[model samples]
Target: MAEQRRRLDPAARRLEIIETAERLLARDGETVRVEDVVAAAGAAKGTFYHYFPTWDDLLDALRTRTFEHFDARYQLPTEVDGPIDWMRVLDELAAAFVGFTLGQERLHDVLFHSDFARRRPLPADQNATIRLAAVIRAGQEAGVFAGLDPEPTARLLFAVLHETADAVAEGEDCERSLAALQVVLRRALAARPEEGSAQ
Candidate 1:
């Protein structure tokens, strides 16, 4: 007789399904099906549906989760009392972003370069653009960045970063690309003498 499997808690089951699905996605790229995830997760089809209504929904959740992980890893320091070093902060953020992209190429492609990504609008609160916008706003207040509006500037920076990340993911030299990108970002956002130099 076969041994019986222990039942998983709802939260544990959901997480198992997401993790299983991610593994399958990494192994099979975007061609992975919901049935494949169900089998890999050792769950019934209905169980998978209970947690994620559709395949696209699961993909979106995975993308959001990935971004959350990245955010937690590179979150800005909020406890500084003195003047902020905006240039250093930006450099740190850029390095972290590029490093994550290079290290998690498959996940990065799924989150930012997939067909589902093209179809759905990303949540603003969970997006890197919003986080970068906050940094830009802080720089403006600290007289370390140009007086341009933060939202558009952040969006443009995000766009540039996304493109550069994609290129790196597709086999470009990460260090060279990141260096060029940093130069572009600094040039685009560098404050004038009247605004206060980042130095």
Candidate 2:
């Protein structure tokens, strides 16, 4: 029964450990020990060790978890009645961007300023960018959006969103920063017609 019980808790324990560790690591971006997570999660050190034997394991888990969360939020829809519009996409990205920055206050500043971001410019967010780029490409193919360079456009949008997240993570007015990001991104990506606009 002990083995079965371990199995039962493995899934839950693993996530709990990761989530707890992410929350803590975000704080000031300092080192997080196994004992800290164990105490916070009210689990034995063995439980944390079972999930992540090393500190690097914990960091990798946190990065993966954050990316997973970001990806899940990336392709979500807005309440707009029409098909996916540039405004809607920008709004969604802004919301997700703000959510990631604001929700993980402890890690945001450190993550942005640390070598992690600079070191990995094309982090796991590239997966999300590829996913969103495909959607934008579909929009263009379907004639919803004007034809344009999808790759550069998507990267530009991501850069804007990242900058907004940085501002928020730096303790600026996060909500306002998100709103500003939405405006900036929308203006940058708003589709123009293939046909010349009449005066």
Candidate 3:
């Protein structure tokens, strides 16, 4: 049998409890309870109470859980070596986001519709800045992007990508949305030379 790991500190225990509770929430839907969380993590009610004083606190924990989660859960593939085209990277990222959203729609609805988005602010690591930098760098090298502010461009990319999920969740034509977004991305990232050419 594999050895069971243990946490020694109170703070780690509390985080463990929160993370375990999130798993229950993800797996059991809305039926999960605080007792279930304490029981599963093998922590006492005292520990749970110390971490979160009331139902609201637990809900707060859940919100933080959702925020950290969406950042790490569906990250881009690591095997993609040798820099790829910016727009192509966006295409892959869009598909990944849509797929991840669809898979986690139930939990996502709880997080967004219930104001969980407001609980945990965006973390630096989860900021998508590095991903954006990668795309911007590649586009620059390929001579397809110039006179652009990479950081803001990344933010803009995120806004456009968010629309994909909105269309999907609204039961609109998802494929049409994806296609339309792809075109928009291609235009946004298209090369612009220093000298003007006749239109």
Candidate 4:
């Protein structure tokens, strides 16, 4: 007798299917087929259609999921072990972003650099810029960042991160580029000392 596959609820089943497709996409690029995804996920064709009515719908979900994973890596710190080192937080965020971009090269390109991506951009609020601005605002409140407009500052920093990561992805030396980027970011955002502090 063959072992039975455990049944999953609607939400779990949907997420499982999406994640399975994500793995396949990462492995096979745009050449990946719906049948390949379903077969690999141990899901029926009907089940896939239940979650994603069309192939494009699945791609959209995949893009959203990829961004979610990227955002989760740099989410605002809810709990601190000790004094918050905002600079270190920024550094870690930059490093994590770079690591993800490099580690998931094919997936990143397929989801973000392809023609399909140009046609469908993420909504404003759900973008990485918004998340970075939130971090900047938190840092400003903590007195670690200067009194700069968080949104614009985040936009600029995001551009820097994006371009630098692209450079690394396109053959620039990762260590050198990343180190320079970190220095540039820290210097640009560091809070200045009080003007009259010297006695």
lDDT of 3: 0.68
Q: State the TM-score for model 2.
A: 0.70
lDDT of 2 by residue, 1-199 (tens): 4455356557887887777777778774666667787777777787777777766566666766777777766765543665656556657766776676678776755445555556545355545567657656766765655566788777777777777777766778977887787677665655676345674
Global lDDT for candidate 4?
0.82
lDDT of 4 by residue, 96-158 (tens): 888887777677777777767777887776687888898888888988998888989999999
Clashing pairs in 3: none
Q: Candidate 3 on 102-174: residue-level lDDT in tens?
A: 6665665555445544665445654555566676766777676664677888788777777778778789788
Which ranges in model 4 have alpha carbons more than 4 Å from their true place? 1-13, 67-75, 79-82, 115-120, 123-125, 194-199
Candidate 1 stretches greater than 4 Å from native: 1-5, 79-81, 194-199
Q: Which ten residues in a row have the lowest lDDT in candidate 3?
A: 1-10
Q: Rank the models by TM-score, top first.
A: 1, 4, 2, 3
Please provide, for model 1 over 55-149, each residue's C-alpha lDDT reduced to its tens digit, 9 standing for 90 to 100. 88898888888887887788777646767688888888987887877666465667677888888878877777888999998887888889888
Better model by lDDT: candidate 2 vs candidate 3: 3
The per-candidate count of clashes, in order, stands at 0, 3, 0, 0
Candidate 4: residue pairs that collide: none
Between prediction 1 and prediction 3, which has the larger TM-score? Answer: 1
Q: What is the TM-score (0 to 1) of candidate 1? A: 0.85
